[model samples]
Target: MSTVFLALQTNEDTRPIIEAILQDNPGAVVDEQPAMVKINADGRLVVRRETIEELIGRDYDLQELQVNMITMSGNLDQTDDEITLFWKS
Candidate 1:
C-alpha cells in the first residue's frame, strides 16, 4: 500500500467536528492547522468532499466548506489500517 496525504482549510472552531469525521473513518487521521485541517486516512487523504455537501444540506456554510486548495496523493490499502497524519497551527 502507498501513503496518501490531504489538506483542508477551515475554521479553528470546527476541529472537533472534523476530528470526529476522521475518527469514524478508521486508519484516518486529522490534523488541525491555523485556518486549515489536514487529513490522512488509510492511503487516501483528502477533505471529505461529500461531507461538505452533506453538511451543506443541514444548512452549514457552503463557502466555509470551499477548500482554498486541496491536495491528494498516493494509493490506499483497502484491507488494513496504515496511515498517519500531522498538523499544527
Candidate 2:
C-alpha cells in the first residue's frame, strides 16, 4: 500500500487537530520533529471537521487546517465536513 502523510506546525492550535486526525485514522503513525508533527498511514488518512470540533469543544472550519499545514502526500479530496488523502491505486 502507498503511504499518505500530513505534516503540520507544532503549536497549541494544532494539538487538537493532531488528536482529531489520530482518532479518525487508525494505524496512523506520528513522527514529531523540532517544530513539526508528521502523521503517516498506509493507503489513506482522513481529517474530519466534526472530530476537531468535538476535541476542541467548538466549531471548526476545515480550511483552518491550512494555517498550520506544512505539507502532505496523496491525492486530496476536501469538503466542508472532511478532508481525505488516499492513493489512487
Candidate 3:
C-alpha cells in the first residue's frame, strides 16, 4: 500500500490535534521534528472534529487545522466532521 502523510506545526494547539489523529488512525506513525510533527499511515489518515473536541474538552472546527498544517500527501476529502487523506488507487 502507498503511504500517506500529514505534517503540522508543533505547538500547544496542535498537540491535541495530533493526538486525535493518532486515536482515529491505527498504525499511524508519528515523526517529531524540530518545529513540526509528521504522521504517516499505510494508506489513509483521518482527522475528526469529534475526536479533537473530546481531547481538548471543547468544540473544534475542522477548518482550524489549516492554521497548523504544513503539508500532506494523498487525495483530500474534507467535511464539517472530518478530513480524510488517501490514495485514489
Best-matching candidate per lDDT = 2
lDDT of 2 by residue, 34-72 (tens): 999999999999999999999999989999999999999
- Ranking of models by TM-score: 2, 3, 1
- List TM-score per model, in order: 0.45, 0.98, 0.97
Candidate 1 runs further than 4 Å off: 12-24, 45-51, 58-66, 75-89
Query: Residue pairs in steric clash, candidate 2?
Result: none
* Better candidate by lDDT, 1 or 3: 3
lDDT of 3 by residue, 10-77 (tens): 99999999999999997999999999999999999999999999999998999899999999999999
Error of 1 at 41 (Å): 1.9
The models' CA-based lDDT, in order, is 0.50, 0.97, 0.96
lDDT, candidate 1, equals 0.50
Q: Report the poorest 10 consecutive residues by lDDT, candidate 3.
A: 58-67
